[model samples]
Target: MEYYFITGTSKGIGKALTEAILQNDNTYVYGISRNCAVKHARYHHLHFDLSDTTALRNNLHKVFVPLKEAERIVLVNNAGVLGKIDYIGSQATDNFEFVFDVNVIGPAILMNTFLSAYYSQQCPKIILNISSGAGKRPMDGWSAYCASKAALDMLSLTCQKEQELLGTGVKVYSLAPGVVDTAMQAHIREAESDQFSELERFKLLKENKELLDPEAVGKKILQLLKQPQQYSSVLMRVDEI
Candidate 1:
């Protein structure tokens, strides 16, 4: 059986990804999130707040379970928050901590747990961090978010290097899933023009129906995983897949 532990399974791309992975009867999914939105025989939901790093670390045993004959294991760090949508100085300093806690620190802990849990398991291991294009570029009001994702990208790359040195057979990737039509996008569109310089552009993208569908993006990610060898870069974009 193939086991996949995914974060943020309550909504958006995470929920879509979980549903897509469940299409196969031989696969089992452990979803980590505050709430559950899917009901399936192979799906196991674990309720936890990603921001609470201490609780998450203590309860990771529920996510990484032993399998009789596991074919593969995967970790998808999909949960993220779009911190305060204002210029750096205009937003509260605490917002940076909140954003980093959810986006970078949470995933880092989970990745560590996954690696340690399956240290001796003789199966293919993959870690996919759901990053954003914002990480690769600077935006007016997205300083915290962009910085967090950039940190995530570097973390994934550094982890991949370590795994290679240790011969751990782990493939780590930090991928940007483009602009999906998720609640996050709605939040971006609603940002005030004074805070976010590109507010009108984001609104136009939504009005023009240019945003990628969450379901489609989720399926594409799964397809990309099928042939991981074709891509060598640790940092990637969904469109490239």
Candidate 2:
């Protein structure tokens, strides 16, 4: 049986993805969220804050210690923070630092920890990072968000290279899920009117129903995991799949 370790499963795309994956009869999902109360026969929910990186790392080690003995591992680093909207110069340093901690450093550390345990097992493994289009193209007021995603993209690419160097079967990719209807979008829409750009653009997009469904993205993720050979070394966008 294949096993998936996913984060941010409390809501939005993460929640949808977790449910979709658990539908498979041979699948087991370890979902990490700050507020995970949902119970299922095949799902294991663990509550922890991503802000505490060391604690998260330790907890993940504990979770995988037994699983590593039996099955293959797939790590999905999906939890991320979209910091307050502000221009580059006007943004607070704390916002940038916090974003990096959640988006970049946390995932990198998790990959390192998981790989250290999985290396000896020689199991087929993959790390999927939930990145954003902001990483590919800059947005005027999304300084922290854009930078954090950019860092995450690089981290995934670098990890893939390192895996190749070690001659390990593990593969990694950073994926952009596009604009989805999530609380994160609500936060962006409610940002200070003056600081946010193209409010009309967002409104028009919303009115035109341009947002992708979270479940659709979740299914695509499951497809990727099932047939990973199709996406081994590149950063994939949801639109492309």
Candidate 3:
């Protein structure tokens, strides 16, 4: 049997991935999100929000209960938020905290618990941190989003190093799903040109029908989980898959 623990399952790529996993036999999914929109015998939905890190920490022990029956375990930290778009000093200070809370703190908390909870499970373990190109290249008015994702990439690298140092067979990747047609893009396209200088680029991407589908990205992610050893421990970018 194989197991998948995913966040942000209420919508977007997380929801698509969870549904895809349910189609497989002898597979189980432990999904964390604000709402449980999926129903299946093998799918277990855990209620939580990434923006609320306190609740996650308080209930860390409650997760990963079905790991013992699994031959392989995969954790995908997919939940994230794009904070209000504005110039660095023009945006509210709370924007940074809100964005970092979901994009960074929540994933870190979940990664810690998963590593510690299933440390002894002799199985193929992998952690996929859904990152973005914005994390690698700077974009004006995306300060909070870019910073949080950049930190996520660094954090994933650090975790990969620590796992290797300790001889844990866990592989980690900070993957960038380039320009997916998600609600986040809608939010970006709605931003005023004053703050997001290159708002037209995103608008044109939409007008030109260039946004990638979430379902397609979900399939590639599933393939990665199935054959993780074929890729590098710290490799990234779904386009390369």
Spell out the clash pairs found in candidate 2: none
> TM-score winner among the candidates?
1
Candidate 3 local distance difference test against the native: 0.90
**Please, what is the TM-score per model?**
0.98, 0.93, 0.97
TM-score pick, better of 1 and 3: 1
- Highest lDDT: which candidate? 1
The whole-model lDDT of each prediction reads 0.92, 0.82, 0.90
Worst 10 residues of 2 by lDDT: 62-71
Instruction: List candidate 1 stretches off by more than 4 Å.
Output: none
Q: Candidate 2, 22: how far from true, in Å?
A: 0.3
RMSD (Cα, Å) of model 1: 0.9
lDDT digits (tens) for residues 105-145 of candidate 1: 99999999899989899988899999999999999999999
Candidate 1 displacement at residue 194 in angstroms: 0.6
Question: After TM-score superposition, what is the CA distance of residue 137 in candidate 3 from its true location, in Å?
Answer: 0.5
Better of 1 and 2 by lDDT: 1
lDDT of 2 by residue, 83-147 (tens): 87887788777887788888888788878887886678766898999999999887878888888
Deviation (Å) of 206 in candidate 2: 1.8
